[model samples]
Target chain A: MSDGVEVSVVLPAYNEADTIEETVRVTLETLDSFLPAGAYEVIVAEDGCADRTPEIAARLAREDDRVRHVHSDERLGRGGALEYAFERARGETLVYFDTDLATDMRHLEELVESIRTDGYDVATGSRWLPENRADRPAKRGIPSFGYNTLVRTVLRSDLRDHQCGFKAFDRTALESLLPAVGDEHWFWDTEVLVKAQRRGYRVKEFPVDWTPKGDSKVDIVRDVFGMGSQILRTFWELSVSPRITRRVSLGAGTALVVVALLLMTQYLDPQAVLTRMAGADPGIVLASALVYAVSWPLRGARYRDILSSMGYREHWGFLTGAVFISQTGNLVFPARAGDAVRAYVVKARRSIPYPTGFASLAVERVFDLLTITLLAGVVMVALAATGSADQLLVALTDGAVGATRPPAGGPLSPSPPASASPPSLQ
Target chain B: MTAIVASARTDRNFVRRTVGALSDDSYADYVAGVVERFVGDVQTVAADASAFGRVGGASLLIWSLDVVTAIVVFAAFGVDVTLAVVAVGFFAVSVGNLAKVLPLTPGGVGLYEGAFTLIMAALTPVGVATALSIAIVDHAVKNVVTIAGGVASMAWLNVSLTKAVEESQSAGDVEVEADD
Candidate 1:
């Protein structure tokens, strides 16, 4: 038992016979120069190595007591091997790095110093920091930038490089974070850092020189999907789980209903409304219904003309039908699901592109608003000429709907305002 | 117009930056491809300016018909419809229709009625009760006709309401796939 070791450097290796030896030798040399000989140990966690990596690592362990090799017959993946080694490490501070040593070893001193002196629980190497230098092909750089950005945005974490492969942690911090990290693969780094940040642990990032060593074993497409799913899962667990969101929604909904009911009670009188509705003239109702019927065809015609202009020629009936169905959908669904339905209907019927259909729908709405505003302008002009604008403004500001009583003897006012004689439909 | 143009430009820049940061070159290329197709459609639409003019003209006519409906309702209640009433009714109808865009209630049912009645009471010599009665009658007329016309169109187009609703709801996702 290396109970006296203050720093334990863990190198998780898999099929890395080519670079593992050099990485271990350089890491040992770096540790020897800065850390005392008996205070630190290098651990090689070789898991499911099909190459000569396990044998070479075992030989090194036999040659030097400072070097220790732990081998697993079955593949536990990089994260699993690290976890296995981490459990057995006896040092106060544990460091882990990829066998390829893609990150510069010179940053090791600062990374260790950050935890040892600066009071940070974890210190990580960041290739994305402004002072950091990363030499890699554009094909790799672009995806790396995008993936890191997605991790930062979705997890809302301050750490820039979650998968930098070079990191050091206080043993206590790792113990607290490891149990919550569910991923056993490449996402392990992200999960650990995210959980650590959420749990209020201080994380420091140091700029490092990173160079591509050899062909990467990662499947970019599969790993991107995997990492993205993990980010979403972590986000859900930390911020938007049903436990929190459902309670918030219920509270907000209850508050809104209470407010609406208060407003309704202040503004509406049920008995007055019932009496007025009972006295409504059927002849005028029929006429208004006819006018509404006329508006539908006009609306349909306008939509047909708009679609035709957009080079999506559909029959007038079809365009009208689409509008009618969408309106009905709006009546039934929330969040304007009707608009989505309308775009779908156009695509399914006319073979128009969805964006084009969406653009047309937007334009249609703009036109409708424009027309309404134009007509309102005409009314405003008339009102200004008659000097009735003040009356309207007064009513708007008064807040009391019943304060501005109509002229008692005016022909427009019903005989008994709220209890007027019922008007006959005939 | 200036405000609209500036807002659109700002929105486009925001979208571009957000997408660029969140995706690779291939995803950007995919987005650019969709934008190009949409631009082509817009250009085609712009080339035929007369069609939009015709549609605008028809919209004006439809709006005028709504004003006439309001006048008829006022006269039926023995309100002695005047020019001022006609103008106020037109303004109320326009405001009410615009308010329907807000999903305060399904089809802006309560909102439109409340807005139209309040506007009538404020602008015309009509009492609140009378204005509310007019508003209710107007909405009932329009909604009943809309439901009837929608059902008829559904039959004519061989679309079931249930199926149409479902399809419309998922249409955006389908469009996303098609865009891809």
Candidate 2:
């Protein structure tokens, strides 16, 4: 109701009929102590109250011009109610505190002045700071400590007490941050503060005297589980989503491959494989590995040619690396998932369109299949020229027991025992 | 060549219809351009007759190296280097690589080994154990080489695979927005 309200204090009320009148009176008296008449306004954000809290707020708004009553038919959550009232408030500096007024009223001036005159973007009272005078019971204190610690560690926040209700925000700063803040309920405060810091806003956290109030509506399941998921969501949005650059993708891909390799040991004994590999001629195996290594650059060259024909000329080294990453992704992921990975790499790194990337990859694959068929066809012709056609027929049909074509159900048949005699060399 | 062109046309139309159904007219048009560009690239390759010859040469050379790797693994097992066995190894390697293209498993690990072992065992006088050993060793060597090259390339390119996957996953919407 004030004409030139510089500060608006919103009290989010949900069925607080017993204390609404006294809380508003005390809030008015506190405002009168420091602010000039008509300089500040008190908004009772009555959020779908089932009791007479809305009536009391309406009466107070009517009785005093400094008090304003805003009612919501539906339960706009705590943060929602505050946001609703703040948008309607005619103030450059917006402040909000719990209806309980657990924090000493003496700190109210400091909280408002920090944003109004001190030039800070946000200011919040802390109950977790070493210098605080909060008389917290063990039941509340332990969970609060754990929650705040989690917020600090997971969200990378600097604030010690994020959920402190006694907080003030610069109107412009709050508005700039609200669009990105996804939470509507209890996680709102932590998200806002974390995002505020990330966006380079100067936030001030001051210790305040506080007393433990009566039973709060903190459900064990919702607060712990629901908010726990919210933390991960915010962490992803704040820390992971924006920075999902090519480097992070490669790192994640590598991590996935490593995890896949680790998981393979559960199904296949790695020690047995390593021992078998060791039993082989190490020199010949090294040569084989080197020969395979040489093919990678050629693979890169083929990829470059395919892309170049598409009018997207790129460095051969870069193409080779892209091929390598995609192939590696394929090695660890199923159904040629690495193909898309390669497409993604080229599109992201070279600004080539996705369609082109995919097409170039397809072109490369066509050549691969063609080359494979050509090799098999040439070898088949050679076998026929040498009077070995009968051997090919027998192999195609059934030559020996346990040596037929792989079954349709699975690729790997049971391995024969190690002591089995080596078959004829030629 | 005719099959490639026909497939290209079918793909372009499919892309256009699919995109048109999902988005607005302007966005669909932009997506159609994307498909056109893709089809154009494939057709360009198909048009250049020598491009096929050159790619064939490269692929043959690369796949020959792959066959050579298998031959070397056979040599490590002390198999005689007979022309008949080498020819059989070439066929088995080619067929094994083709089997891997099925995408049944990562890098077709089990699939490649199965096909190679089956062909080598049936064609030659090799025991199942020796054939499976050769198949496993050959596939493992190639896979190890591939993984090493991939890691080296990642470090060299200074790009993130995770980020690329994420962006590529959301590429449809992002491309439409950019074009619109």
Using Cα atoms, each model's DockQ against the true complex is: 0.26, 0.23
lDDT of 2 by residue, A205-310 (tens): 9999998688754554346545786899898887888988545654564565467557546644556546555566777779889888888888888777777777
For model 1, the superposed segments whose C-alpha errors exceed 4 Å read: A1-268, A381-386, A402-407, A410-426, B1-47, B174-180
- TM-score of candidate 2 restricted to chain B? 0.71
Residue runs of model 2 more than 4 Å from their true location after superposition: A216-218, A255-426, B1-180
The alpha-carbon deviation from the true structure for residue B16 of candidate 1, after best TM-score superposition, in angstroms, is 14
Task: Determine the iRMS, in angstroms, of model 1.
Answer: 9.0
lDDT of 1 by residue, B36-124 (tens): 44433333434555865687688788778877777677756656566667778899988988777765455666667778887988876
lDDT to native, each model: 0.73, 0.77
